[model samples]
Target: MEFIIDTVNLEDIKEAVEYMPIVGVTSNPSIVKKTSPKDFFKHMKEVREIIGKERSLHIQVISKECDEIVKEAHRILEEIDDQVYIKVPVSYEGVKAIKKLKAEGVHVTATAVYDLMQAYMALAAGADYIAPYVNRIGNLGNDPMELINELSNRIVQDGYDCKILAASFKGVQQVRDAFNYGSQAITAPVEVLKQIFANPSIEKAVNDFNSDWYDVYGEGKGICDL
Candidate 1:
């Protein structure tokens, strides 16, 4: 399973990527606005440097029309590296853009999906990843896991090369359920992902282990001391 962090903060990306098993970094217009970088392309280049060339970096296009979206995708590729995944919302025009981009061998991630049919359309357009808004769907009084389960089943049955990259998470449980429901990847805020270790019991357990070790090794002494 791929773990992706959805943030534009350089410090958070550097720290999280170092500690977490992160596979990618994803950002949308909203995420970029949060940082308000003076130069968008330069900031993204820095992000690419920190993550290096191995991990994928997903950047979204702000255009609504198919033609503009296609142009934006090309610009993003030129601004960033070609390996970066161009994120397109799953819509009529977006599907067209995805098809055009895929035709040119561009890595495309279909986003803003809330329905099974939308995801199916993205998969048909040869998208490398399809992102379903998990929390948004749940907030709309719909069961997001149902969509994920059915989509997962459909992907396996249809033999699609696409992966389910679940997004819009609020808590760690949402992230866990996304994976449990067969999402191959998830992009969440660094804070939300860090919540996985928020339990007080976890610290207490570690403290207990350390205390026992201290009794034998003496306080502040470690295995290296030997």
Candidate 2:
């Protein structure tokens, strides 16, 4: 499964890439607003440099009209590298844009997906990735895992190349559930991702092992030192 970071913070991205197997970085307008970079394209280029060309970089388009969305997608490709995935909301117009972009052989990610129908539309429109808002769907009193399961089944049955990129996670459990439910990729904040190792028992186990090693080798001694 691919672990993607859903933020625009360069420092967090750098740190996460250093420690975690982060496959991609995603950014929406809200995420971009948090950093408020002076030059958006330049900042994105910096992000690309950090992640390198192998990992994907997703940048959302702000346009609402189909034509403008297509134009913006091309602009993003021109401004950023062509390998960047253009994220379009799964709206009527956005689906149209996805079709157009896909026809042009551009990488597209359909975002803001809340329902199964939205995902179906994006998949039919040939989107490379479909991002469903997990926490937001749960907050709306809908079962996000069920939706993910259904979508996953559909992808396998229909033999579609599109991947389910689960987003909008509130906790580590939600992230795990997303993967358990068959999400191919999950994009969450670094803080939430770090929660995977937050259990005290894990630290205690490590401490206990270190203590045993010290008992045998003397204080502050390790196998590598010897």
Candidate 3:
């Protein structure tokens, strides 16, 4: 499973990659607005430099019209490098853009997917990834896990190449459920990911082990020191 960070904060991205097996970085206009970088392309290039070429970088298009979305995707590729996965919303126009981009062999991620039909359309359009808003869907009284499960089954049955990149998570459980439901990837904020190790029991266990080791090894002595 691929763990992607869904933010544009460089410091967080650097820290996350340093400690975890981060596979990619994904950004939407709302995420970009949080960082408010002075130069968008330059900032994205810096992000690419940090993650390196092996990892994928997904950048979203802002336009709503089909032709404008396609043009925006081209502009992003030209500005940020063609390897960047252009994220287009799963709307009528956006699906059209996804088809056009995929026809040209460009990497496309269909975003803002809320229903099974949206995901089906994206998969049919040959989108590389389909992002379902897990938390948002749950807030709307819908079962996000059910949605992911159905999509997962459909992908396997139809032999589609698209992978589910679950997004919009508010808690660690949501992340775990996404994976449990057969999502191939998940993109979440660094804070949410870090919480996986935030439990007090984990730290208490580590401290107890260290205390016992120090008591037996004579104060500050450790295995390497011995």
Candidate 4:
């Protein structure tokens, strides 16, 4: 299961990249607004430089019109590299833009998906990725994992090429749940990824090993050299 950190802060992005072997980063308007100084393109360029040119950088288009979305997608792709994944909401216009972009061989992520029907719609509309908001659905008192599992099964059943990406993860539990349900990717916050390594036993084991090694070697450069 692939994981992408959903953040715009450079520090958080760098922290997650250092700790986790993630493939990419996912950014939205809200995330950009949170950390950036209102210059979205500049922030995105900073991210592109940090992650390098060969990384998958997912950016969302806020416009509702198909033409506008397509134009925005093109702008974002040009801002970074050709590896950008344009994320548009799951709507009629969004589907139209997705089809057009996909026909042109551009990777599209149909985001803001809330239900199983929308997931199928995204696949039918030729979207490369369908993102289901797991914590958001769970917040609405719906079983988010159920949707993740059902979509996973349906995608495999139909052998669709659409990737099921689980988004809006609350914590490590949600991340683990998405992978457990066979989600193709899990997009989560950087803090959540850092929390995954917070196990006390793992820390204790590493500290104990370091202490023993130091005691045995007496801070020597190499035991063999001694």
lDDT of 2 by residue, 72-174 (tens): 9888899988999999999999999999999999999999999999999999999999999999999999999999999999999999999999999989999
TM-score result, candidate 3: 0.99
Q: Compared with the true structure, what per-residue lDDT tens digits does model 3 show for residues 4-106?
A: 9999999999999999999999999999999999999999999999999999999999999999999999999999898999999999999999999999999
Ranked by TM-score, the better of candidates 2 and 4 is 2
TM-score for each of the candidates: 0.98, 0.99, 0.99, 0.90
Instruction: Give per-residue CA lDDT, model 1, range 67-184, as digits (tens).
Output: 9999999998999889999999999999999999999999999999999999999999999999999999999999999999999999999999989999999999999999999999
Using TM-score as the yardstick, the better of models 3 and 4 is 3
What lDDT does candidate 1 reach at residue 8? 82
Give the CA lDDT, 0 to 100, for residue 176 in model 3: 100
Ranking by lDDT: 3, 2, 1, 4
Instruction: Kindly give the number of clashing pairs for every candidate.
Output: 0, 0, 0, 0
| Candidate 2: residue 26 Cα off by (Å) | 0.3
User: Lowest-scoring 10 consecutive residues by lDDT in candidate 4?
Assistant: 217-226
The local lDDT score (0 to 100) that residue 219 gets in candidate 3 is: 84
Residue 83 displacement (Å), model 2: 0.3
Mark the 10 consecutive residues where model 3 has the least summed lDDT: 214-223
